[model samples]
Target: MTDSESVRQDTHPSGTWDDIKELPPSAKLVAKVLEHNEAMTQQTIAEETLLPDRTVRYALNRLDEKNTISSSFSVMDARRQLYTLDINP
Candidate 1:
């Protein structure tokens, strides 16, 4: 399998500690929130985590860069996006 596939198969909400160990505190916090909750929008995340919108946005960007999360346009609101962990494991 390719490297990306390998990483996916080895990661999940419950199994992402290792994968996120090197990430910053904000990223880790964002990841944990995603782990416990289902798909969430950036605003929802900020509310739930009590983090600033800018911080949450930065964390989400970091997670996205790490291939640890994925996002899709929200069905309820076309202008908003829903985020979820890329946990296949």
Candidate 2:
């Protein structure tokens, strides 16, 4: 398997990506960005994925519904929230 595949498997032995497979393409993209970056705000995710803010927000909501990602208010900026993968990819 490729390195990315290995990482995906490592993220969740049962297969987090497998769970994500049914989600929207935008959600998958957002998950990938979070996997690589570890943690970031919605704006950063949008910048990294080159997706619009609304699209990113929608993706985040989808991920949230699946319990795939976690978020906490940024210590430096309470108005912003830092998002991270709950699955540890």
Candidate 3:
């Protein structure tokens, strides 16, 4: 990879961790859950984390604001968005 690309990759995890550290506890829990799983819908995340749906939604918004997580519409369920970690944990 190019030097810039290498540097970006090397620093991304630490940067992401720093951002995550500033987030609320609920957002941190959501990040942890995404770290362990491949990808999950908000409902699935709520179930896995045992958090309320509203809390999960709030956490997701926080994570998204930090660019620590990415989401895409699920193929099987258009209404559901699958969330995944954008950084390595």
Q: What is the C-alpha RMSD of each candidate to the true structure, in Å?
A: 8.0, 8.2, 8.0
User: What is the lDDT of every predicted structure here?
Assistant: 0.75, 0.75, 0.77
User: Model 3 residue 50 lDDT?
Assistant: 98
- Name the weakest run of 10 consecutive residues (lDDT summed) in model 1: 1-10
Candidate topping TM-score:
3
Model 2 lDDT vs. the true structure?
A: 0.75
What is the TM-score of candidate 1?
0.77
Model 3: pairs clashing at backbone N, Cα or C within 3 Å: none
In candidate 1, which residue ranges exceed 4 Å CA deviation? 1-16
> 2 or 3: which has the higher lDDT?
3
Q: What's the lDDT for residue 19 in model 3?
A: 82
Mark the 10 consecutive residues where model 3 has the least summed lDDT: 1-10
TM-score ranking, best first: 3, 2, 1
- What C-alpha lDDT does candidate 3 achieve relative to the native structure? 0.77
Q: Which candidate comes out best when scored by lDDT? A: 3
Q: For all candidates, what are the clash counts?
A: 0, 0, 0
Q: How close is candidate 3 to the true structure, as a TM-score?
A: 0.80
